[model samples]
Target: MSNDVAILGVGMHKWGKWGKNFVEYGVKACLDALKDAGIEWTDVDFVSGADTVRNGYPGYVAGATFAQALGWTGARVASSYAACASGATGMNAARAQILAGMADVALVIGADTTPKGFLAPTSGDRPDDPDWLRFRLLGAANPTYFGLYARRRMELYGATEKDFAKVKVKNAAHGFKNSYARYNKKFTEEEVLNSPMVSDPLRLFEICATSDGAAAVVLTSMDFARKHTANPIKIAAISTVTPTYPNTVIEMPNFATDSSAVVGLPDAPFRDSIAKAAYEEAGLGPEDLDLAEVYDLSSALELDWYENIGLCKEGEAERLLNDGETTMGGRVPVNPSGGLACFGEAVPAQAISQVCELTWQLRGAAGERQVKGAKVGLTVNQGLFGHGSSVIVTK
Candidate 1:
């Protein structure tokens, strides 16, 4: 019972403020993926769509919506919503169907159309909703949370503003030639520091923007892959675990962490557990990774991902960045596709975009940003609430 699923093809609609219906972007990506896989739309028997709650009715029934848009042939459909982790959830669903012998070929897709400015909670007046309360009561938008994390790094790890700027500089350079990236121009440390400070120590350029984009992947069982392609990248693991009780970290849109008075701390923190679970499922470790594409909502957050994904020890992420170990041609190049730094946050589409980058890197087709000879790559992302996402892919 090998839990492997082949990634036959991956595709994306260029990330930007396209100002079009999300379904349009989704369909384009799906068509691109189908073409890349060298298969007809009829070949797909399952459709797993990452949902967008902000987009009204079509977004709610994303799986069926996409099926209809693609000229439906009665494919079984499922929709998933896990905030930013939506794409990974959809991918996992498709993989499960393939592994369960329910479907030989499947399409996993995500697309988003976001508004300008900081992402806020849904339109509501509910007093119990922490998402709305955070904005209403504390005025704590996303950048506020990013600021808190950046300040924590400075105070705890002796990281400086320059250290955070370096992350932007590095990623900007990596994505300079990425055709799909929205903000591809490279920046210098001085330019990053000179930008307006939106959230305390974090400059405006250090934060990821909200944009419109789409990404899609075609997946099949290992047996089907062997007949379709000579050497296809296989999904070694997909971890969408939730947090354990007494989660101490006060994450996004939450005012308080779980009280530790009743229950003791778990064996691992929520973030650490994300990649650890994936590694366990894949029987691999950080040492096995050739590269990684992590959710870098902010420049400082990228440093946190290094430790969370076992790339380096806790508090050593600054040193890893300064040492150039996490950059291209380094020990483990993280975010060679430039990450959120260049592409911005397209919500549901982002996690799928990360996997698309991994597939290209594994095939050594990632043009200028390619991590040389990359064989095994990992993608890690987290979203609102306890949603955790991580995927391991091997060539």
Candidate 2:
């Protein structure tokens, strides 16, 4: 199948605790996207949903649930569950249908009504469930994993707390201009440094908050897009990859590191592997991107993505950040929409939200947060429990 899918429309719900149901937010985003696409629900040929565990029993069957809420039009449906990468996985599935000629117009939706406080494990104390065991045994909350990565970067790349704080400062400044962001307030290095510690090496402001939001996108075949609109943003690649065996890295909510007990870990890091695949599929390199939106669950993680996505060499992320290269007007701007650091983490909705930002930027609709003259853009995120993500979009 041809690797060509046009992004016709994008929509999103503001990131915050709006005290609303996930399905309501999903419907709102869907309607907004359909309106933007100049199409109605009945015009959709397929629907793909990114599922959230907190959204009740119907969450698992997200596509059908959303379809029913939107008044079903007999559209083909699919639901994907990949933890944080759920939304990107849904895009991958929808793109497959479009490329295969199974569907010409597809709607992708992701929404989440997150629980307040630290995200807890699933109910019941089943030792078989790794999510439960990690919380029960180690009490190693998500921040703990972030701390591990932060510390590793400090040790390996000489990244300082100040360097990490700068990331928060830059993102917060950008968020202040983003109306949809959760914490649209600026912060200084001292403020970030003084914030309460959630885990060693990670302060409260350093970690992204759990947010409630929804995002949707309308995707169609390039041929269909050309007939509908003279200018359409295209998704050149969608990479839904998995980690290589012997993944020594201890990821979020995981009890133990992938055992190095067998053969050693793979030659390339798991995060970089995702980008490599996307680059191969799109036939483009990181140097080709005008801007990027990466998963910045923590200020430190953003730096990690800089290296993983090939924006800089290992140990050079902090230098990029320090030089103001990753900010809005700088070279190869990243997370121009303020990223998770400012918008907070919306779980299932985040990956889709990233694309929404990219769509606006590519369309020159992004106001204050625009990466000037952005043409080729990329969105990179990682899902827990073997789900990986990377999406490359070009004008």
Query: Which candidate achieves the best TM-score against the true structure?
Result: 1
Instruction: In angstroms, give how far residue 77 of model 2 lies from its true place.
Output: 0.5
Query: Which RMSD values do the candidates have, in order?
Result: 0.8, 1.2
Q: Which residue pairs show backbone clashes in model 2?
A: none
TM-score for model 2?
A: 0.98
Q: What does candidate 1's lDDT look like per residue over 176-197, in tens digits?
A: 9999999879899999999999
Tens-digit lDDT track for model 2 on 272-388? 999888999999999999999999989999999999999999999999999999997899989988999888888888999999999999999999788889999999999988788
Please estimate how well model 2 matches the true structure, expressed as its whole-model Cα lDDT: 0.90
Off by over 4 Å in 2: none
Structural RMSD, model 2: 1.2
Worst 10 residues of 2 by lDDT: 253-262
